[model samples]
Target chain A: MATGRIVIDVERCKGCELCLEACPQDVISLADTFNAKGYRPALLADPNHACTGCALCAVVCPDACITVFRDVPTPKAQVALEV
Target chain B: MATLTADITEKLVYQRPDALADLYTHYCPGCTHGTAHRLVAEVLSELGMQEDAVLVASVGCSVFSYKYFDVDAAEAAHGRACAMATGVKRVNPDKIVFTYQGDGDLASIGLAETMHAAIRGENITVIFLNNAIYGMTGGQMAPTTLPGQHTTSSPFGRDIKLTGNPIHIAEILGSIPGTAYSVRRSMHDARHVIQAKKAIQTAFEAQQKGLGFSVVELLSSCPTNWKMTPNEALSWVRDNMVPTYPLGDYKVHEELQSKRGRGR
Candidate 1:
C-alpha cells in the first residue's frame, strides 16, 4: 500500500472548503483554529493512514495551497541462487 | 519466514504553478479570483510564456493582477485595460499580451475600449471575469448584472427598464468580424475549471498565432460581495449565473478550429 502526505500553505489557504470536499479519502477538513489572516486553514486527519494520494484536493484547490506527495515501496534485496 | 524489508521514497504528484508567486493574494475567501489567477498562471506556464508575457492588469478587485502573475505586468486605469494592451502588443510584437478585466471595467466604463479592440482585431488575449457586480466597490450592479438580480445599487432587485439588459460580451465580441476567438466558461466546479483552462489555452494560442482579439469570459463567483457562503456561491454560479450568461464557444478562428479540441 502507498502512503501520502499533504502540504498546505496555511497563509495562502482561504478556507474555501473546496479541497475538503474534493479529498476522496476524506482526510481533509477545516481546522478549528484560524491562521494569522483570521481565516481557517484546511487540516488533514489521516489517523488510519487512509490517504491514497490521489491529489484531487490539489487539483481543485483555487489558491494552490495544497501539494500532494506519495511514497512507493522500493525494491527488496535479492537472494543468491544456488547452483 | 524471513521478513522482506524495503524503503519508501516520496514523489511529488502536484505542486503550485511557478508562474504564480508564493505570496498569498488579498482576495476574500471563496472568491474565484484565486482560481482565475491559478488558471491564467497555469496556461502561461504550459505555453512557456513565463518570461514572454505582458499582462495589462485592470482596475477592480483584480487591480493587483500584476502581483499574482510573475510576468511583466502594468496596471491600467479603470476601463482602459484593452487600450493599454493594444499599445503594449503593438510595441512588443513578440510577447504574449493579455488583459484581466472585470465586468464593470470591460462592459460598462470601458465598453468602447473593449469593443474597438475587438473591432480592430488586436492580437492580444482578454481574460474577462464576469461576476455581475462591482466586487471591489461594495457590490454595485454591474453592466452584466442579470435582470432582477439584487445588488447593493439594486437593493430591491435590478429593474430591467431603468438598468437596461445585461450585456452579452462574449456574444458581441464573437459576432464581430475582427474577433478571431471568443468563449465563455465557468470556475464553479473541478470539471469546468479544467474546461476553463482549455479555453485559456486556445485564447493564448490565437494571440501567439497573431489571429487577432481573443476573449475568454469566465463566469466567476463573489462569495463576499454576494453575501453567500463560499459553497453556496458556487452553487449560485452553476444554477443562477450560468442561465444568464450561458457557456460555450462563440467564435474560433478557422485555422485554430482543430487545435481547439486538442486540449480535450
Candidate 2:
C-alpha cells in the first residue's frame, strides 16, 4: 500500500528501455522530445499513478539515471486526511 | 477509493551511489559495464571502503573506468590488471584493491596474469566483465565468445570445431585452490542483477578478510556489439549466454560459507 514515484535524469538516460520492461506496473515510457544527448529518455507516464516506488527501474537501469521516491506518513497534529 | 493517512512526505529511496563520479560514461547504450561499475560503487560505499580502496582499471571499453570512480586508481596495460593489482595490494596490504576487466582483457590477453594471481593467493578482488566479444575493437571474437555466435572476426559464426569452445573463466578459476571465491552472475534482469550485486559483495568481503583472490565474473550485455536492441540483448544473455555459462557460485571458501550461512 505504498505510493511511490520516480524521477528520470534525462541527460543521463540513454533510453535503453530496460526500465520500461522492468516496471511491473508498466508506468514508464520513452519521451517524444529528445534530450540534449539526442536520446529519447524514459519518463514516468503513469496515468493511474500506480507506481509503488519499488526502485526496480532504478535497479535495472544500466545508466543509473532513475531516482526513486516514496511517500511516508508524517505524524503530527492529527488531521484525518483521505488519500 | 479513500485511505486514512497522516501528512504525506516524500523520501528519496534510491539515487546514484556516492562512490560513483557525477560524470557521463562513454559506454554505449545498454552496456552492462555501467551497471557493473554502479554495483561496485554501491558496495564500496556500503562498506565505507571508498577512501581505502584502489581500483585497477584494465584496457578495453572500460579503459576509462577510473574516471567514473572516486578512488585511487591506476591504469594497467592490456591484460595486466590482476598482475598490477597484485603489486598494489602487496605494497599497501591494508588497501582494498580490485580490477575491472573485460572479456578480451581478462580471458584472452590477461589469462596468464589472472591465473597466476589466483594461484599466488593474492588478497584482491577482480570484477571481470564478460560480454563475449571484443567490444572496444569493433566487436571481434573473443576467448569467451559463444559457439555459433557471429562477431566481426567470426562473421560466419564461431566454429567450436576449429576455434575450440568458449573459455569458462569462473569454472576454471573456481577450481584453483588459491581462489577464495569465484562465481558467475548475469545482468540481464533485475533479479539476476541484484544477485550479481550480492555476489560482488561477497567477493569483496573475501578480500577484506584476507581470504585470497576473489573474482566475480559478470555475464554482461553489449547491445551495440551484439547488433541488437538493448532489450533484445538482455534476452540474448538469458537465452544464449546463461546456458553456456550457468549462473552459480563455483567456489566459496569455508570461512565465507560459514559467514554467509548455508545455501547461496
**Local distance difference test, each candidate:** 0.88, 0.92
| lDDT winner | 2
Regions of model 2 farther than 4 Å from truth: A75-83, B1-6, B258-264
List where candidate 1 sits over 4 angstroms from the true fold: A1-3, A72-83, B1-8, B261-264
Model 2 residue B231 distance off true place after TM-score fit, in angstroms: 0.5
**Which DockQ value does candidate 2 get?**
0.66
Tell me each candidate's TM-score.
0.92, 0.95
Per-residue lDDT of model 2, residues B1-264, tens digit only: 133344577899999999999999999888899999999999999999999999999999999999999999999999999999999999999999999999999999999999999999999999999999999989999999999999999999999999999999999999999999999999899988888888889999999999999999999999998999999999999999999999888899998885342212
TM-score of chain A of each: 0.86, 0.87
Against the true two-chain complex, what DockQ does each candidate achieve?
A: 0.51, 0.66
